[model samples]
Target: MDSSPHKLYHVHGIDSRQFLEHYFSDEPDMAFGDDLLKFPIDSLRQLFTVGHIKGDILIDLSLGCFIHHLYSASEFFKNIIVLKANNRCIMELKRWVDERTGAFYWGHASTFLQEKEGYSDQFGDKEGKVRSAIQHVVKYDPEKENMTDPLVLPPADCVIIATLLDVISKDQDDYIRYLRKFCGLLKPGGHLLLIGCLDTTYFTVGKDKFHVFTYDESFTRKALVREGFIIDYCNVKERTAVSDLVDYKGVIFIAAHKEK
Candidate 1:
């Protein structure tokens, strides 16, 4: 039950790089099946295309690998702050942002977004936009009851979270508590873009497996409402693969606003 940093790769997708291509590609595969990436990015693509989100300050709650979804935030936000729960995630992000050797290439995903959003056909435009917009990458501990207990961050106009709640929380109450704590960092009426898994008990990165809090759509909506959020947009996709490596009912994407 030890959720140490060393074992976090089991939850953060470091254990499985091959499955990552599917998360960013429009292609189909049977072995690894579908992951939590493509669907959420598609949902975000829709949300950002409509101009529903605009802000100068945006905070990313988790350093989701291949977060080309940042293409959306970079388009509007002047500053982007990524808060990571695990040091490894932060290091990986820095690797790409700094364009270090052996870093996972993100240009393909960014180019896909630029073309999809009709911004630019040239990939570097979107890539530069994101690279320059990213202002900070710091470690964040969700286990801290007071989310800002140690780090004093400015209230953000928008916050983006993915796959953190389900894997981090011990149970429903812990999930709700963390949700409330994170929402407190958002300014009143600020926007929130969240993505989570549904009815999943566990998942594997490579050789290791990690636990997840299984919850349904109803639970997600209620949790948002309980945390004083007004739902704006929501999308849910049924799990396509039930292999031993990955098992889940679905993935949910919600764009909500903190009630003023």
Candidate 2:
């Protein structure tokens, strides 16, 4: 249990190297060309192959940098459903994806499309025909959130992929409950792909702030098992040189499939 900061940092560096090797290696042929985009798509590819995903509804719970990667690789996906708390991220994703595949975009603040009608006014001053492909945007509150709420979702046939699941309290029990609620969003045998800080303190995104629940592989795996997901495969990768301004250093990649 050597928790010395220097020792931990060194270990983190080594783990990060290993992760880069596995993610960047060309031999696997599944390697994503960009370093930033590799892990999410690679993990998704693994899940798709292992779980036999095809022509299935895919949902991204939070739209971050990974959302772009998802859209770029959308040809391989059956249908893309994206969810985000930020209006700007949703709009950007919508604009980008619509330019490529005519896929719609939705956010918590603006409705690009509601039902069959298109809300072109919502996307003011944008070029190109606002495709019916764009969907409604509604307000999302992670606190007191449930998967069963009709107003909060699209359909049950969606695979839930969340880039960050840090809304719950840090206690293990609370974390388990949050994951259960996330899983409840999908249909039976659907999959859940989660990416977040494994055992870290806090993360800063612009001026916004967030904290991790200090999770490890064993704790997360057990929680998923309790939530009715079979542990298909799990990989933990560390991030080194995260920032020059701060000494921050922990990140993990986790992928799991929902069981019937």
Cα RMSD to native, each candidate?
3.9, 11.9
Candidate 1: tens digits of C-alpha lDDT, residues 1-260: 33643334323545334434434434545332234554665678789778878888898875345566687778888999887665566677788789889777665566556556675556776677888999988776676665545778888999987777877777899889878887777888899998888898776655666677889999999999988889998888887754676567788889999988
Question: Relative to the true structure, how large is the alpha-carbon lDDT of every model?
Answer: 0.73, 0.46
lDDT of 2 by residue, 10-115 (tens): 1111232232233333333423233234444455545554445544455656524234234222333455655555454455455554665532332211221221
Compute the lDDT of residue 82 as modeled in candidate 1.
Answer: 85
Clashing pairs in 1: none
TM-score per model over all chains? 0.85, 0.61
